[model samples]
Target: MTSRTAQNGGHYGAIVVGGGQAGLSASFHLSRAGIDHLVVEKKTAMHKWRDERWDAFCLVTPNWQCQLPGHPYDGDDPNGFMVKHEILGYLDRFKAKVKPPILEHTAVTAVERHAAGFRVETSAGSFTADAVILATSLYGTPSTPRAAERLPDDILQLHTVDYRSAEALPPGAVMVVGSGQSGAQIAEDLHLAGRKVHLATGNAPRCARFYRGREVVDWLWDIGQYNITIADDGMGKKRHDTNHYLTGRDGGRDIDLRRFAQDGMALYGRVKGVSGGRMLFEADLTSNLDAADRVYNGINALIDRHIAEKGIEAPPPSVYVPLWEPAEEPAELDLAAAGITSVIWATGFRPDWSFVGLPIFDGTGYPVQRRGVTAVPGLYVLGLPWLWTWGSGRFLGVAADAEHVVEHLTAAVAAPRQLMAQAG
Candidate 1:
């Protein structure tokens, strides 16, 4: 490795920003295609899997889905969920095997159009490339509601990215906002850790971890659920928008809103705002729970239909009854009286494309691309949710999408050389 100062103004055929799964996968494809490329990472490879995730976090997808370029899980635990360390180890092994040309601790400061390609200015140095693939995972920046700013300064407020374990938080009831996968899991973690947890529920879909003796993921895969592309129709778009609130806890068990309520976790509606130290919430808790139940039932129906149509022998469907009695929705929460001393905003994340000085983003600041290909030549994005298929952002599908982008990029790189050869 060269000193940062010495590598200033270097050039490469291609540049990949981020050293996560997406970028590493892209580098593998680029290297195999004999393309001269450099991968610039602000932190170590798979930094989020190592640092940002919580202590108990596990892959919601099963081990078999942990597919990267030239690496697939061949272990016996295909149905088992991988813990945080296991995922990190897998990424490390993949990195060692592929050996992508990565410049660690090199943060990209700005990326601007340079002639037909791009000029990437980083903390380490500036580099020009014929193509640039922004593989910085879609969820780079933690997004909190605007109301969070109004909370008292004394309250220890942290986003999911900052949360590790319940011990890290101050002693008191913890209010976890957001009912998506992260929020639900964190709420469970806090509750299991003996903290009085209050969860702000949303309309995220819920699914059983296993259905008919097979993992839910396996069932979904068999039914071609992950292959649903954006162009399929409005139904595909709706499926892309819905967040699956399944848990990989307890070696992969079903997670439902009713379970949280039965476990004595106070469920509130979607958080509306905060004023005078009181957090206002919508009175939609029951509706949200009902909606999740509907989604679960719908998934079961689909599975049943698939089994019947294919004559697949599977275990009988298990009937699930609500474990908790419905309670009146609390319109507001008095933080002080409830003894809540901290808040974990598991409100999810958005892409941080501030470094990309381009007009490729949509109104929501997400890149507007067609399967990772941007309108701007030589500029691409990978590992984005719903980039092509439902699994585009997932570990199972990131490498395929990366390969798709690199093929086009390498072709573009080769075009000029071929033209010069023909001219000569």
Candidate 2:
């Protein structure tokens, strides 16, 4: 391999930002290609998985999908989901397997074009590399609605990132906003902990954990759903769609909010805002519930069709029936009167690319990349949802995207040096 080492204290053929699974996956393939690279992480390699998630957090998908390059899920339970510590153990094992050169506790502040290739400014020091891989996962800045500020100053509010357990909150009812995967699961976690939970449902879809005698994810894998690319016709819009709410906690099961309501957990619609010290909600609870069920059944129907076409024998398909229905849609709730003392915003996050000193972005501020390769030469993005396929964001597909990006980068890095050597 040709060494095009630019004059700098920290230089490499490639510099990968973020030490999460995505970054490590890239380093794995880069090493295979014999490229001299370094993985720069803002925190320890397993920081996010260790610190960001709640105590009860587990993989919503099955464990078989945890496919990092050269290191597949070696756990005994492929069908079972790995909980918080188990997930950390898996990642730790993968890190050891790849043995990538990594610098932890280093925050990358900026990346701009440089004469050599790209100049990366970090807390530890500056680095020059022939290529840059922004391996930061899809989540960037935690986002809570502006209305959260209007709530009475006394009511404690926390985003999902800060939530550890229901017992950690002060003794009182907890209101969880957003019905996405995080919201629904956290609500269940709190409800199961004997805490009164008021969940504000969103438009996020839901799906069954097991369907037709098999896991829904396994069925989807058979149908090649995970392989679907963003470029597929009519699939581009799916990139922004909220993930289907389910659970892998306690083995695995569907998170049925209806049953929770029947058991006494209060349910509300999407939060509108706080006014006059009362939380206001849109009167769309019934519709949102129905919408989620529709998606749930729709997926089952897809699986049934796939089974029929392939002549695969499976149990009879079953549709979800609403166990409980709201008699009246409550539009407003006085926080103090309801004894609500804490609010958990599972409203999700927005990508922050302000540090990237480049114009390769869309109107939405999302990086414009074709399966990890950016428009700008030698700049790429890895570990983003829908980067190339549906699994790009998760452990299921980061490896493929990383391998593709590293292949393209290695060729680009070698070309200039090869030409320069011939000229000399």
Candidate 3:
């Protein structure tokens, strides 16, 4: 649904959809640059951060890295992690601080490229705008496999978004599918909380916990490690998610896995099917897990040299032990023996633009764009992971990208604007 059109008048210079970080960044820049724009958020203000996360959620990034354009977090723990509530409050205060024209609870239903610019439609109302920026994240929608539909009713299956805390779960053995960040973290939490856990494996990259006396993420920015993708080869794009550098799902960012396995969490390659009160799991997660382990060692060596050369001295980082040995091939997991009950599918998410029938999307259903600018003039995307490079899609990295988008947003529609002199 959409909100009613502005009471005073017509199309805004720009309209931004979704009020998440990406949208906030874009909107904030537009505001500072003196652009008239509206930020439309469908859910309750900061609903994504407030509801989507478990209470224990803390940003993997230290507060120092949580900087946005024109505003940064002001707190004692700049070097510490920002919890979900902190982030939500920060955004809330940021929104209040800026007070940009925002339409809350009003969702954008359609955006047809109009000859003038773009015709926007929302539950509130409709108007034409010079451009539209989709900062709504690609992860807003939860993805479920076709196999999930076939799972019998006896098995309680829920996506990671539905998961709040271990207490949200019903009592029973649980199969936590997908071993990516959320999958691994959730499995570890539930297992440690005393639920029997089975993790379905898939391809995952890994990372090191610390490098040269600091959290590895610090090195990611300080040394411009992820920036390496700016000069990436054709091979890098194909393996964006699989690439070894940042793909490292090292538990150092979340929770350690060596300790996770020690708690009796069962590992499997992948989940193939489900029937009765059971689901089937395979043995393929080992290769990706092993690859992550190898990379961790490689990171250690790099960090070691940095320490010696730079005279960096501090407590040693915890050594990452590979939790599971290399599984030769697939093996079927019997839920009975595994003591599996509810299945927490912590698999990742992607965009749900299916309802948005726009020609701007390419073969992969991803918008074709150079940076955030799309092939369709007056249409743009912001906050997409790897939109330009490995770091382009991250929260810390979006500021540089937001500048690029704002520049285009301002210059592209310089004409027909109601100048301050003209307005009076």
Give lDDT per model, in order: 0.86, 0.90, 0.70
Please list the residue runs of candidate 3 whose C-alpha ends up more than 4 Å from where it truly belongs after superposition. Answer: 1-9, 229-258, 302-330, 355-358, 415-424
Which ranges in model 1 have alpha carbons more than 4 Å from their true place? Answer: 1-6, 235-242, 318-321
As a whole number from 0 to 100, the lDDT of residue 33 in candidate 3 is 83
Q: How many collisions between residues are there in candidate 3?
A: 20
Residue clash pairs of candidate 1: none
lDDT, candidate 1, equals: 0.86
Q: Model 3 scores what on Cα lDDT?
A: 0.70
TM-score of each: 0.95, 0.96, 0.86
lDDT of 1 by residue, 1-424 (tens): 2112326777788999988889989989998999988988888888888989999999888888888989998567887888888888888888888888888887899999997678999887788999999999767889999999998887899999999999999888999999999998888889889999999988787888888988878898989988887777774354237577887877888777787778788899999999989999999998888888888888888999999999999988665666775668899988999999999998888777899999998766778888899999899999877888877777888888999999999888889879989999
Ten-residue segment with the worst summed lDDT in candidate 2?
A: 1-10
Query: What's the candidate order when arranged by decreasing TM-score?
Result: 2, 1, 3
Ranking by lDDT, best first? 2, 1, 3
lDDT of 3 at 109: 82
Instruction: Summarize candidate 3's per-residue lDDT along 1-424 as a digit string, tens digits.
Output: 1232464226788988877777878877887888888887887655777777765666665677766776677778777777667787777776676565778888788888776688778887886788888887678778877778866666678888878777887777888787776777677667757787877767765566456467777665655555664336662363237433231223235354444666676667777786563566665566656766776777666666666667777566455666556434546666656655578887778787653546888777777777788877678888877777665666666777888999988887775455634886
Better of 2 and 3 by TM-score: 2
What 10-residue stretch in candidate 1 is worst by lDDT? 1-10
